[model samples]
Target: MAGRQPRRTRIGDAVVVLGVACGLALVGVSGCGRSGAATGGGGGGTTAGEVAAAVREAADALVDAGSSKARTSMEMATGGTRVTIRGEGVYDYRKRIGRLKVLLPQDPSGAPVSRPITELLAPGALFMKNRGAGVPANKWVRVDTGTLPDGNLVTGGVTDPFTAAELLRGARTATYVGRTEFAGVPVRHYRGTADLHEAAQAASEANRRTLGAAASEFATSEVPFDVYLDDQGRIRKVRHRFSFVNEERSAPVAVASTTLLHDFGAPVDVRLPEAEDIYAGRIAKE
Candidate 1:
């Protein structure tokens, strides 16, 4: 706990943000048969435009699917420590409600810990439960995404289905990776690499967290995408892998995540934790 604590914290923050982005991306919209057989190939048979169109179609379908459950897994390596997170949750984009149970790495005492968090989109707030990390154990801190000092909370736009569609629409080099089975369902895979600058620019205005240099810096890091669509052209899974060097450090941190979307168009119920379960003191942001 004594060596390079701040740096490790930054790494943890980076990975956590990435995990949330991926998780949010997993629960939006759902649709069936949007992908067609006529344009499902990856190599000589498919063009970038076709692939982009397919992605856009799938994105729209997902949005239409309304509510669904998600299972997310993330892995990160920073310096010498490696950590993994597993999460399961239900999200209703139409109603802007979500509940998540995120399993974190073990504590210093070797006990497992987790952040049981929920989002009440009506007021655009994120409620995070305090684990035993110095904060009161019985209270849930409310973080108003709209009031954050930085535009960081707005990064949710990066995971928005429309934003994702816009990003794919700008992809000049997309290829069909061919048809395969994913999660026991037949799917067509497509791979695309978008220019970081263009990808950042393509984010919907509503989803843009910051403008100018900040946005450019976000794009400065490449985003390699692997998109999977079921037989009906409905999106079944999406994976993003990104890596960058921190400041002047040559050692790089890499993050990889995968999100699977299923149980499309399901009815969802998201209730806030009971008042008794919430702490009345000032909520601390973890």
Candidate 2:
């Protein structure tokens, strides 16, 4: 908000440890299992081309719906410890903005480490309050999404709802899993892998640069996902498995991010913090 530049802090750095452990665990488990293949009863006859095309159009479908309430979950596991971060919010597709209250997991002793963080997600920026590492609780820390590795995808812990759906634009391989009910609504499930580079090429102008940054910084450009689409082709639920290199560990970190959209056409009002309300001082590392 202020004209002064905030200290450059990599959001990804705070979550790197969780990523490394989760990535290693995923690799070990994957080696013992069969390839990820679609399984279920509905839409078995749908062709791969048809499924891919339908999945790719899901993002546009959401825009047509206007807005929705969203719930997000991000899980990371290493060794035997698994932690999950949860968020609930509302998003406006037309305006490309949303507000989420994110709760961090409890400490090992089952004690709360901090209060829930309030996050405002906009086109190219992220604003957070109660972020806690030496910052005033009343001030917000703003980060440019385009400057973040993974394009603020895994870096923010909770992937932005709009970006999660837009990622489907790059769907390269897909199989119809079947018909299912999500939040009491009928939906068709599809599973596939998307190329981040291709998604960046097809993404809207506001998201192109952010996603392109992710494509170049992640350990791999390919993202695996499972998505559920309603009758109108709107996304009911989507889950993305992201991998990024943890420089210190010299290994990839794996994060499973899930987003659920419902209450279509819900009212959403998100206001960005004023320049005077933003903290421009140096932020301490987590």
Candidate 3:
């Protein structure tokens, strides 16, 4: 292990895997917004085709913007374990970087998982800052993205609005529900069903990896989604509920995920931790 980038700590690896699923859940919906009461069946000019077009347009616009602030809330249950996560962060699609503060659930081994960890990400690198008793104060523990197979890292790449638009490719049906307001912003809401695997297969090579990792559960399931968009076709909100039978428990497990995107063109400043703060010191391999 000498001279190599340190292997991510055990906990860091778990975070990365979870983030893969979380990022897909967070950024998988885009495009489609307010068009003033048009329905999906060509009612008053809102056809299913038009709805799909709107989603694609919105998704394009988000990718072009490069970066934004995101807030996500999620709940998942399997067997007797239930996990809830709430996070807010700045996501940069261009660099595949995200600086997030997340609240995690208890570990599988029954250890109480840490809450609200701040993380930095890239295609090959993931760094975590957890102010726990065993960790150094203000130091970031680096987690190698290679630790997980198939290109999963810290989860912010495809979550970028621009790349996330690829998810709409799997949409089987679309309906314009009517006008609404989100956080006082005039918007439009739409509902649809999509095959998660289809979208993953259509994503860009770089994005497909992250998407593929997250779609493992929903691969065989056609899930419903509710999407809200602003007048300019920017994504405002997206909601989805996923239900499946737990393979091990032979019981039902359901997950609800919601993402809110805002602060378009926000400044995202990410800095790696200084050297002195790192707890691990690697000896050169000579």
Which candidate tops TM-score?
Answer: 2
For model 3, the run of ten residues with the poorest summed lDDT: 1-10
Error of 3 at 148 (Å): 5.9
Decide which is better by lDDT, 1 or 2: 2
Which candidate would rank higher by TM-score, 1 or 3?
1
Report the C-alpha lDDT of model 2 over 216-270, residue by residue, as the tens digit: 7654677889999877778889998864444344334456899999999999988
lDDT for model 3, on a 0 to 1 scale?
Answer: 0.55
Question: Tens-digit lDDT track for model 1 on 125-210?
Answer: 45655443344765664544434321222222123233333344334456898888988888888886644345435543433332
Question: How far is 116's C-alpha from truth in model 2 (Å)?
Answer: 0.5
lDDT by residue (30-110, candidate 3, tens digit) is: 323333322233233267667865654455556556778988766666555666776788877566666777676556667
Q: What would you estimate as the lDDT of candidate 2?
A: 0.73
In terms of lDDT, which candidate is strongest? 2
User: Using Cα atoms with residue i matched to residue i, what is each candidate's TM-score against the true structure?
Assistant: 0.66, 0.84, 0.65
Q: Give model 2 RMSD, 1 decimal.
A: 9.2
**Reference-based lDDT, residue 259, model 2:** 96
